[model samples]
Target: MDFDALRRHPDLEAPGLAAADAADRLILDESASALAEVAGPPGSVVVIDDAYGALALGAMDAGARGVRVHQDPVTGERALAENAERLGLAVDERPAALPLGAGLLAGARVVLMRLPRSLDRLDEVAGLIATHASTDVRVFAGGRLKHMSLAMNDVLGRWFERVDVTHARQKSRVLVASGPRQGPASDWPRSARDDELGIEVVAHGGVFAGTGVDIGTRFLLGVLGDAVPDAATAVDLACGSGVVAAWLARERPRLVVRASDRSAAAAASAPLTAVANGVGERVEVTRADGLEHLPDASERLVVLNPPFHSDAAVHTGIATHLFAEAARVLAPGGELWCVWNSHLRYRPLLERIVGPTRQVARNPKFTVTASARRAASPLS
Candidate 1:
């Protein structure tokens, strides 16, 4: 398989951005033995967080069939499909992208994964595999050496009886684990009360800022009351854990609130957050690629705390993409309220992409801005 030929298109592609990396190659190489061991139906092999189609496609290229896959980012999901088509893999040879649930884990004899930065995220994946997968399942989790930690072995230890570290290769390593442990029922979708904000924060392991508000989100909340006071409907884009959507519904009794995110964890956590805050009926949660599911010129206002990174690499292109999406979704004269790192100086980009941008609030670390949709714009 030509891993180097894969491209991260439909994602932010730059000179340094890659569709596959050393960690991916190492994972494929390390999991080859287990791949040959997979038997029976197509679902016997499972892949998680495949950056593009490297792990899944590579496994398929190695002759493993019916690979079930799950990627948290919609961009990665699209990239995988595009790469598969580009590689000329047959329809039956392509991997099935599934959500992080029983269907993705059930009856799996082998699992390949890219180690997530969040230990909680890893814990969740490990727990699901332990509970739902075959007792003899062999797990191969790999990542760059810089991103690997001893704590991951501890997390896997909780779910599996043994975890063995593989020798380093090109700054990448893999953790092999077998012997699933039966434990107490899963304790996911954790929740905690935020007394200051008067709401409950619900989170699954993979969701950002699990069970708490980040400083940027906290800053956004402080000024949220003044965001488009007359608008009847609003959207919370990149809505992690749905803190903003839940807050909007509680503050504005008449406002229709929608929370959308690409992460399965965030999608699962948001509605729970709404229910915990007693706003479940008012907040609608959707797992989607940034407002792609939204109709053009359909929203009066949108709130965003756009992510600054594409995976581990810090890139401003993600925020720019969100700003453009916000502009497309907002009706003429509608507004986009956003919070970002002050140093990024997104005001100029916001002005160009959305409309006339104005500073809403600012501190040493963060800047909050409002941009209105132009009655006519170049991008629109």
Candidate 2:
């Protein structure tokens, strides 16, 4: 398969990573039967966490009839759609990311995936495949050796009777597993009480930071005690697990809140977090890309703890793009509350991109800043 034909979304750029990686090729090469299954009938093969269009398009190129695919990032899904149209290929795309179930896996004899970094995520996926896919299902999971670990083997072993590792090729390797064994039902969407906040934090396996609140967010929350503007509507941009959004809704009962993220798991888990905190009715969660759909200067407040990494690559553009979008959607006197690692030095950039930025609070590691949508004067 000519994997180089694939391309990442135009909006995303990571320094070391290309449009397609060697693991994608290794996966397609190692799973001949699976590729054939995808070409022969629908639901015989399913692809998960494909970074772009590589796996699905590669299957189509190999004469696959119908390939069902799920991508965790909005950019990846859009890139796949764009590539499919560019290549004139038809792919049976899932409506959302990682919607693991019988509809996606039923009668599927083969599962192809580019392994995710989170072992918890892999655990959930492996369990789902073993439980929902055909009893004869064979899973081909591949990734870079640096990203792969013995723990993945252990995780897959929990759900499959056999897990074997292939020799490394081009810095990538595949884990071949079969003999699906029935396991207990999923333990995801788990919730735990937050004693300090007097609410619950709910999370799925794939959510960012995890079930507990991270220190960066915790610090941001501490500063937000009196920071969130009094407004009719506010957004928790890139809301992971919806802790901030739920808190905002509870703090201001009248404010309608929107919690959004690029990951389907995060978006799906947000509402649960809200409901767990008794604010579900006021908090609206969505899987979206950077609040791009909101009209110009329509939002009175926005809060963000933008992710610093893109996939495994440390990329600041992700945060910068969100800042631009926040500036666009925020009303004239609106505020964009942001928290980031102190070392990233985002205040200057924030001032330039949005408007005047002032430090609200800072810890040794994180610095919280609130920038106005359009200040009286732009920062020099």
Candidate 3:
């Protein structure tokens, strides 16, 4: 299979960003024998966190039938579907998309996973497989050596009795784990109270910043009180765990706040946070790509603490995409309140993409800006 033929559309696509990498190829090659053994059942092969359709499609191409797949980000999910269509993979042969749950792993013979960066996420996933997958199932978890660590092996040790590391190929390696250890049920989607912010935060392992507040979000929360006071409805674009949405709804009793994120974990955690904070009635959460679900000029206020990284790479394209979405979603006189790293200096881009922009607040590390939407502004 030509792995490089895959495209990362619906995701930020740049020359530097690839839909498939050496890691994906290395994983497929390392697991080729195991995949070939998965002949009888439809879901005998399971692929987790495939950045695109690489692992799932590759498995199907390698004669693995009924491949089940789960991807954290909605863009990755969409990209996989589109890639399958582009590659002319028959509907019956394409991988079945599933959520990260027992059903996804039940009766699985071979599991291929792209190792997640977060140890918490890895723990949760490993726990799920150990608890649900077949007793004799083998897991092939692979990633670049630069991103892999001894800590990952330790995490896997908790669930699997044996873990064998494969030799590095093009800076990528696979960890083959078997002998599932009987263990306690997973305790994921943890919750904690932030006394300083007077809010309860709930999070799944895949959520950014986990259950505690990050420094950047803390800074943004401080200035949220002044964002478009008269707007009856507000949006929390790229909302992670619904902190901004919950805070807005709690502070303004009558305001209707909608929170949207691309991450499945964030979408699942946000509503729980809202409910815990006693703002569930007014807070709406959606799992979507940017603000695509929203109509043009339909919102008066939007708050964002945009992410700067795409996977492990430090890319500003994500932040810029969110800014353009905020501009499109905001009403003519609406405002976009955003907090970003001080060094990025997004004021000029905000001015060009949204409208008149001014610095609202600034700390040594973070800068908060307010950009009023212009009736007509070009979206870059």
Candidate 4:
């Protein structure tokens, strides 16, 4: 959406104030508004992340030098730069992008954040904030009231000295936190084990199946080890936190593994996971919708644990699009290995797109399937 559109849209204003204060800074999300209010006019340096770019832009408009840390190379880089330039704000020389726990914010004064959907990853960010921020730093966080959990408040309280909530504006509330003094950091234990894989997988709070590896992914991994025939180039479509691609790279050191996801947060975390697991040199991660940016027939194997949700609702269109993209990007004799909920009815769709799809394995929760792209038509 255009900047003018974002500013003028009623959805961007506080709930009751939209009509009365249309000319006021329009915040796209509730957390952003609360952050803007608590930070109280960003001075000197203002730190923001992908979730609250609009709020950052608002702060920049109000005379703050906004520094945005984005994980997604595509949207993150483009949006932050373009938005800052649009508002006639200066960009800082410090790194424009950072992984979730890279300890980059050593001297940030005011941090404005929008709570990410992945709660476990949020804890990691909290730990980093606790370690790096000084006592007087003001951290303003916000989210929809529906999404705010007491557990999150408790976690924030542990990291900051005092925490308070703003009244609901547009069905969303902002959290105000004062830092400088925080509880000692503690390590959360890993729950899943794959001794052969050599990775200790742990989930902190809000990751999907954070306590253990996902059953569908486990099934897919089993089939992948057997089905892939000397794969030299591989792509892990929807590579959340790089677990699948990391495992793939560890299993086949000679293969080039590429991981990608649509979420900016996932893109940031995936590369870190790869590097932490000693596969960073071999794995490349990017943020893109499906396989939009990759060339045709570029990879030998494309593994996917396709998602079934769009926002909060379950839908099949995402899986369908992923299959179409996989078919488009696989070379002749290239394979697409995918795991899906067994009840999702993907077998027929796979056959329609890739032709002659076959079931590779099955478990109570999911089905592993494989397909080879059909030979080109004679006309081509």
Query: What TM-score goes with each of the models?
Result: 0.97, 0.94, 0.97, 0.74
**Residue-level lDDT for 44 in candidate 1:** 89
- Candidate RMSDs in Å, in order, are 1.6, 2.5, 1.7, 6.0
Which of the numbered candidates is closest to the native, going by highest TM-score?
3
Per-residue lDDT over 272-335 for candidate 4, one digit per residue giving the tens place of the 0 to 100 score: 6677678889999888878888999877789999888643335676688789889999988788
Evaluated against the true structure, the overall lDDT of model 3 is: 0.91
Q: Candidate 1 has what TM-score?
A: 0.97
- Which stretches in model 2 have alpha-carbon errors above 4 Å? 90-98, 375-380
Which candidate achieves the best lDDT against the true structure? 3
Which residue pairs show backbone clashes in model 2? 39-64, 39-65
Consecutive 10-residue window with the lowest summed lDDT within model 4 = 17-26
Give the whole-model CA lDDT for all candidates, comma-separated: 0.91, 0.83, 0.91, 0.64
Better of 3 and 4 by TM-score: 3
Roughly what TM-score does model 2 have, to 2 decimal places? Answer: 0.94
The alpha-carbon lDDT assigned to residue 98 of candidate 2 equals 43
> TM-score of model 3 relative to the true fold?
0.97
Report lDDT (Cα) of residue 242, candidate 3.
88
Q: By lDDT, is 2 or 4 better?
A: 2
lDDT of 3 by residue, 30-76 (tens): 99998887866678899999998899999888888888999999999
Candidate 3 C-alpha error for residue 358, in Å? 0.9
Off by over 4 Å in 4: 1-4, 7-52, 71-104, 182-192, 195-198, 202-211, 250-254, 262-293, 310-321, 352-355, 378-380
**What's the ranking of the predictions by lDDT, best on top?**
3, 1, 2, 4
